[model samples]
Target: MELEQFEHTIRKLFNKELLEELDDDYGFTNKSRGSFKTVGYSTNLSLETIESAAENNVELMVTHHDAWDFIYGLKEECLKKLKEYNISHFWIHGPLDFVEFGTCTSLMNVIGIDRVTKYSIYDNGDVPGVGEFNEPIDFNVLVKRMRDELEEPVRMWKNNEKQVKKVGVLTGAGHSSNYIKMALEDGCDTYITGEATLYTIQYAQFAGINLLVGSHTFTEIYGVESLAKKIQELNTAIKIVKLKEDHFELNH
Candidate 1:
């Protein structure tokens, strides 16, 4: 499928005008592709480049971030997009991380840590509710796993000296005292987020739970790719294009 065709279909379905603002708010744009190849570097006015690269027919469209920009809008956009395009759209975002076979679940599985639970407590209603692992692992062990898995050293705010057994898993900056309180309510010994803030750290310390800080992009990398890979296995004709987004740096 031509990239432009898909882009147009997606935009029309989602109402690009409304969706575009959401992307701007989150500073969403292409970040990097990590050695992945693109069809060309030239900029064309039309969707010609995307179409040429995608060829005549693209089967599936995979997005790293939520395409809707907002979940409520997402539902409406999804209904519209699905109806217009023969292409199937799959999104892997916050919920995809915590649920079984989700990103955070994948992370936990890789590390062989059990005793986890996940839920969505993001009161903002913008970010969806995600999983939280109630089981804790040694602080150092969790740290090592974060560093090794992400291929980058992580910065953390250790609110408690105790080992982390119960963990709240909210990928990205869904970090807020509200969710932290939810994790605590769920008996999570630690809270894991993509990023942290001053008040959040204080809340974690006061709540008596460990806080694990990973990059929002770094933490979310797995779920969408994993979903795409799964889609490819099911159908080879479907080309899953993982876009270069999540371009941001840790200020700390």
Candidate 2:
């Protein structure tokens, strides 16, 4: 399909108004191609991901995050490679986080969040953030479920022996103390996010909340994969490939 139509469909799928509220970098980073037969989806744009797209003959790449170094204006190499391969690069960041079946919601579904109680506020709107289980679960049991479902190492701060009932979720580097505080205020006994820092752990402990953290990539990958499926449902003619970052590993 034509890249323009594909992008239009994506915008509609993710809600155009929400996308407009995000930074300019949240959409098509580079449009080197006009059309594509195959599209690749991944959690982030990296040299390795670009190479994999090239190897898979993907004419377009839809990623959850732009290359981090692009903030420093140093993604020239990646840009050159995309140009060389004639691969278009598109990013869906905050919108994906806010959309239905998005990052946080997807993670929540995976871990059995029964009902949504609160949302994380973005610039113009809010997304699912805090939820509750049908019944309280043991903290260790919840951690094991997260580890098994995410298939990634889990780093946790077990603040108490309380059973996890009300829980908050924010995927992809969403482990800020501010979010933790919000969860606590929302009456969540547990909080889950992609990654956390020392301060995040301390704050969760002080706030008396259980914290469950997964690798940044693995936690957010589900949303991208879901997007790929959605795109394929829109246009079955356009092949969708889900790319993996084999190099990313969390060693504790």
Candidate 3:
């Protein structure tokens, strides 16, 4: 299918307006945008992911994080590889996270939390910062379950807690003290997310709520994978490949 049509289809499927962020300064070349047969989806558009798509002959790579950040200009190496292979980058960022069944809720389900609800405030229709789990559980169990469920090691900042009944989740770097504060206000005993900030770590201890950080990339897999699955179901004419991340730095 034409790349434009493919993008349009995706926009409709995921509620385009929700995904308000895009690489406004960057877009694919005319030749590269003409067609897309195999679509690759990832939470991060790392060099590994781009190489996999290019090597596998994927026409486009859809990612939650920009392949090149605005601050860095672009990854010159990755750019050359994309141009060399004629693969395009597509981003589904903030809007993707803000959807009703997006990141927050997906994380809640993955961690096996019960009575998960979109209780966090949102910048759009979907909540970005919070999900509340109704049942309290042992802090240790929650850690073990999350590590097992995400298939990644989990880091934590604890407040000498024993149990976690009510919990809040803000997947990825969304694990902010701001949401943790709100979670505590809502009676959540623990706050779960990825990439806990330094200040937030201090705050979690002071606020007396258990804070859990699953590696940022792993916590985010749920939403993008779910998105990829939905995209795959829409049609077989288009091949969608999920470029799963294979490595995680344990002590980084």
Q: Highest lDDT: give the candidate number.
A: 2
* Candidate 2 global lDDT: 0.82
- CA lDDT of each prediction against the hidden true structure: 0.52, 0.82, 0.70
> If the candidates were sorted by their TM-score against the true structure, best first, what order would they fall in?
2, 3, 1
List the RMSD of every prediction in angstroms: 10.2, 2.2, 3.2
Candidate 1, residues 131-158, lDDT tens digits: the string is 3335545788888888888776677767
The TM-score values for the models, in the order shown, are 0.58, 0.91, 0.84
lDDT of 2 at 30: 89
What is candidate 2's lDDT per residue for 1-252, written digit by digit as tens? Answer: 898788778777866666677756487778987888999999988888999999999999999998777366547777888888889999888878877778887788787878876655474333328889898988998888889987776888889778989988888788678777777878889888887888999998888899888988988888888888888898889999887686265763
Instruction: Report the error of model 2 at residue 170, Å.
Output: 1.3
Q: Model 1: which ten-residue window has the lowest total lDDT?
A: 37-46
Candidate 3 error regions (>4 Å): 16-33, 68-73, 119-121, 124-135, 160-162, 246-249
Q: What C-alpha root-mean-square deviation, in Å, does candidate 3 show against the real structure?
A: 3.2
Q: Give the winner by lDDT: 2 or 3.
A: 2
Which ranges in model 2 have alpha carbons more than 4 Å from their true place?
70-74, 123-128, 247-249
